[model samples]
Target chain A: MIGVGKVKQYSNVLDKPLSKGKQEVSLSAFAFLFSELVQYNQTQVDNIAELERRLEDAGYSVGARVLELLCHRDKGNRRETRLLGILSFVHSTVWKVLFGKVADSLEKGTEHEDEYMISEKELLVNRFISIPKDMGTFNCGAFVAGIVRGVLDSAGFPAVVTAHFVPIEGQQRPRTTILIKFAEEVLKREARLG
Target chain B: MAPAGPRSGDAIFASAERVNAELFTLTYGAIVRQLLTDLEEVEEVNKQLDQMGYNIGIRLVDEFLAKSNVSRCIDFKETAEVIAKVGFKMFLGVTASVTNWDADGTCCSIVLEDNPLVDFVELPDTCQGLYYCNVLSGVIRGALEMVSMKTEVTWARDMLRGDDAFELQVKLLKQVPEEYPYKDDE
Candidate 1:
């Protein structure tokens, strides 16, 4: 058992800065577990879309909490504002908090000032995702989309988040990109800010 | 009123890394067992699993915010750093790297390493080339929305093509009102 002092120190240290300590888990375990989840959902899935939706919904819940925990730990209990600014925060901060790395790229919409993109060369989900021949149209990335939607929705960024597969050749893992489309009012605000 | 970003001293990762992983596994096991318990309709069990994940996401949002300590993101760079250091480390025990940075620095790409979650997991013959770890994406999307910044997450490729790498693209969509309604509009 850990002593009170050690626990306090752990709490204090982790509470403030961003930590990069080594922690490992079993991929097979997660895979088997998730497999069961997919299998269970498939039975009730009226269609491929429905099955994916269920998965997305599940992820959405996790996204909500993931966003909160990360922000709380880094900011020491402060909330952020600024639409484009916060999105970048999510691309980097939130991504790191959940997947353990800052995203590969963060892009802004050249045509629409209110729009932006967070790009990663390798998504954590696709790292070991293997779709079966039967479920051809199924892309579990929707689960990720749901999580993004949930996070943004919870944070007051009422927008739609969709997960798509943008495959790039020569890359070992699938390159998945999440597209975020902001509401009209949000664009208006960005225009005014400029 | 809610506290401003980074000011409340709320970002604290109190759980031990090992314990946290165990918690996720335990939760996974429990969810699976419950679903398989009755040998009843699979749909019902799946629904239950989704509901369970939703509940977990809701709670995780609060926990993530409290641990990250990133009250406010002044700009994109700071936001990215926070994700790499605080966000990823706290939950997954790995930090992604930034690659292919745009000249203006407004855009950049992230690379992930040391992913224990993906280590040694083989997809069953039925699901040959699908990503099983998309739960992270869902969790992230749901969590970020709570604090604002309408966003979307997508995959960059199909993982079945013997491709050892995968990517996720994030796009910024809209800005939600600070006092926005939590419930969906009919």
Candidate 2:
């Protein structure tokens, strides 16, 4: 037996109450941890697509939990029922909780009725990340896209979320446009129900 | 060597940019929960966390140096002070107190009053042997290793495990000699 210690036990962590008071954490710690996450995934993948897929998979789990927690905390435990409502929830409430700011704009796709975009001037996840040239077309924002996908999927609005880098002329930082394309069934259901 | 003047932990915390603690605490909680479910073995989860923290530490040290702008430490005693005062404060927004130095002054313990990672954490009965916060030890070991200081870090006490305070003991093993990786000599 191990010596010189008291045997201590406590109830499960889930049993504890989540506090409503706002608390802050160090951003540098997160950036460094995220940088390491990206680096770790890079070593496991043979191509950029695979790496992005890994990151999305990682973020997917987080998205599912965050959706439940955020709804509980902010919406009086009420889940969003409408398409626009959920999108707005994601763009405003979810973004604010995650990034400390609202997204720049939410726009519908010009050519596609089922497509929408949420644009951010600078993604918090990519603040300190510098993608190397060797890893072509790899954006760490894929993780955020996965989170968006997870939230939408959990809320019964099935959609595909992808992050794209769209540079604006006047903006100092490259803008990230999260393209969300809903499933055909969703559009059909919205049309019939609304 | 005599201990240096006590540094203000609040000063370092006030100057850093902050993120919502929920974003960090919840994300980490999810990761740990996922690991517990996927790995099923508490020991394996601890190992994975340590490995991940090691990877984070090697890269995090560069950021720490750039932001803190502190030079090389004079001795192991000073190293412990910097880590307790600047390292923990800058990263976690909490300052640890350095205490319980060994007679040789090569080992010390850092006592942390608050830990963001374990804000809502509890050690389940099934995870009896698991060290939930082993990542902190790994980060300490990994970061110090990079600076040519081979040190062993272990949890002396954990608040999540019903301890009064979160304490980590760091023992200086030896200083690693510098080596030139790409030297060309016949």
The candidate that wins on DockQ is 2
On the 0 to 100 scale, the lDDT of residue A71 in model 1 is: 64
What would the per-residue lDDT of candidate 1 be over residues A30-146, giving only the tens digit for each residue?
A: 443455566667776688888887777766766676556656667777656668667877787776655667888777768875566666666665555777788765777676676
Model 1 chain B scores worst on lDDT over the 10 consecutive residues at: B7-16
Native-vs-model 2 lDDT?
Answer: 0.80
Candidate 1 Cα deviation (angstroms), residue A170: 3.5
- What would the per-residue lDDT of candidate 2 be over residues A1-194, giving only the tens digit for each residue? 11222323346656667667377778977776676567666766799998788778777776787788888888889999888999999999888988899999999999999999999888999888777778767788998898898899999999988988888998776788899999999999999887
Global lDDT scores for all candidate models: 0.55, 0.80
Q: Quote the positional error of residue A183 for candidate 1 in Å.
A: 2.0
Query: What TM-score would chain A of each candidate receive against the reference chain A?
Result: 0.76, 0.91
- Candidate number achieving the greatest TM-score relative to the actual structure: 2
Name the candidate that leads on lDDT.
2
For all the predictions, what are the DockQ values? 0.03, 0.41
Q: What share of the true interface contacts does candidate 1 keep?
A: 0.03
